[model samples]
Target: MQDSPQQPGSTGPTGSTVTSVDDPWVPSALEQERAAYRSARTRRSALVATASTLAMLGAVVALVGSSPGWPRVKETFFSWGKAVDSFPAVLDGLWLNIRVMLVCAVLIAILGLTLAVMRTVRGPVAFPLRLFATAYVDLFRGLPLLLVLFLLGFGAPALQLSGVPNSALFWGGCALVLSYSAYVAEVFRAGIESVHPSQRAAARSLGLSYGQTLRHVVLPQAVRRVVPALMNDLVSLQKDSGLIAVLGVIDAIRAAQIETASDFNYTPYVVAGALFVCLTIPMARFTDWVARRQGFHGAGGHL
Candidate 1:
């Protein structure tokens, strides 16, 4: 008997059977509805996360607020009136910090780079310089920054050298640069070493001198690689600018001390700390952004 006529969706001459049921699978209304349900679940999970986070924060606040010392702590440390009253003086003193930070940052960069280069040189003729640089990094990196400040701020003046500036702010800033440059020098050296050795060989093959190779080919790549680390050091330097107050430089902390002495309350110190936090947070965020952007670009480049 001849085969019955093939239906519209029936098997073809290629020996492959095709029927209505063999058509490419497409989601039915029920499947689509399930997908929509899953999406809704995802959204609900996000909402749940947000709610949980807020609940935890609120619980912490409630716990802290219920403590017996909370009232006194609030009156002393969080008084709006005292904050308002002390803001102007603290702001004025913070300007000094800003100035010192800017100057020290520039000086530190220059000094650190110099020291890094000195440490990296390879010639026997440079032995003394390399030795000196090594000694400097070891000594300063080991010493506390506060001690450096005290020595420069008080001891240097005690020497009564004729040309030394008598100003506490000036000495304190110099000490900061001295101390921070040592740390930053190590950062710079690490960055310098991270550049691939092939890069240097390539530059030399192209007839570039050692200094030219370093300046044109190596340093830039190194700096880019270490930007995040360098920024972290800078943020630390900014905070440590507060340490100058120990030298009696009349910076934000010192100004806060004066206000506290006058008012006999701790609110001024809180205000000063808030001001520092405000200044540091923006830099910290910017550093994070740079790091993330660099990571994303690096990943893309690799792909």
Candidate 2:
């Protein structure tokens, strides 16, 4: 006898079956439509973003161009001719800034690491050193960097110490090291604290001495974790190196000021600012890249 007709939409050995909801092999019409809709929405969003950006930029340009002082401001601050004329002097002066920044950056790193280590020492015998480190951090971090720069740059020379370098650039670099080392020390200390206690315990279990553990395991991890922060402070230090100008050092800012006073035009200051921006952008980009890479590895528990 012939078997009863198979039910509609049911699977059978000899008959074609309807698509099952759980089956991944079949594509749903709803899903295809949703994907198409999403693609359309993304394109629309991009177009809107582009249009908004263009409109906002155009509005800014129009407003600035129509301002009453636009012509004079442009002539004084944005003059291509003046920028060209002043570029040489500003570039020449930036060399001093570079030198000071490089020197202070090295000193800051060394001093900061020393302070961080001093503060982190664990024992009753180390209490005095820890207290001194704490006081040092508190004092420098509390005082404004500008005040420190002034005191070091202007005040130090007044003492007329025989062995001290009287040069403003030297004093400025010293001030930066003293001030930034405090902040950098704190950054390092935070990184050190963030390390899991188990790591230290493991090092101890392996018969490593305190100093050896710190040198081999703790500090390497701490330094790696804090590199992005260190780089950020370095960028700020690079810009603040210009503060040497206040002490009559002929840095880019000082050169620009001289040019501005002579020509009665602000273009040189703009040029100096542009030079600083150029110097800082690459460092900022590098910091960002390090942060991203560290974050990626951290997420994977590789750090």
Candidate 3:
């Protein structure tokens, strides 16, 4: 028998009725959108991961090449196995550097403090004091420290200035103190000036003397402001102490040079370099800490 005609709302094949032509079997709009988003995110994540891996690999390669060599470098740089057995010889020169630096630093600090005070003082005597300080600073700062050291160590004998003969240690140390004192004086002056003007005003308003105001109120803040600068200068001074070797005052560098001359190897210089780095690193870190404490973020702030 022939099939009957279907009605408008009748079920078709599989007993399912279509609602609209827009509905299709492939996917929903929201599902399609979600799939597209996932694919984009996956692609972006893969690209980023690849870039990061490349960067890390490059850094590793760079570090590997930069290192002189491992076992060979250890032997060449430190010579800890055989060369370090001669510890007394190495330490002798190190001790000399320590002594000279300590003595010169003490002298420099005293002289620098005096010069800084004189620079900031007011009166007829103060003017001459300030002028002398200015000239000294300009002279020392303009001259090469090595040349000045040479002149002081060799030339001072002809002048016949009392009991001050041209002894290497004495003259070399004097030159170092003289050069460093000028710089340290400026550091001290900056530290003093960094104190708020209102502090002095308040002290004067309260009937405190100028000396009292500076001693009690101004110097403290100045010290805090100058600590980082002072620490940095100390580090520089430590490095500069090596210059004393030129005056025949055997420091670490000079000792290394003597060893290199005997052994015909550059290992001693490497050793000296390492020693200097060891001295300077802690000082640099301390300066960094002080700077951070004072709310300085290097030369520029990131955020």
Model 3 per-residue lDDT tens digits across residues 133-177: 888888888888899899998888678788666678888888899
TM-scores for every candidate against the unseen true structure: 0.85, 0.86, 0.70
- Top candidate when judged by TM-score against the true structure: 2
Between candidates 2 and 3, which one is better according to lDDT? 2
Q: Against the true structure, candidate 3 has what lDDT?
A: 0.80
lDDT to native, each model:
0.90, 0.92, 0.80
Tens-digit lDDT track for model 2 on 1-303?
Answer: 999876658888877785556656656899999999999999999999999999999999999999999999999999999999989999999998999899999999999999999999999999999999999999999999889989999899989999888998889888889999999999999888888899999999999999999999899999988899999999999999998899899999999999999879999999999999999999999999999898877522554
Top model by lDDT, which number? 2
Superposition TM-score, candidate 1 onto the true structure: 0.85
lDDT, model 1? 0.90
RMSD of each: 5.6, 5.1, 14.2
Model 3 is weakest, by summed lDDT over 10 consecutive residues, at 294-303
Which is better, 2 or 3, measured by TM-score?
2
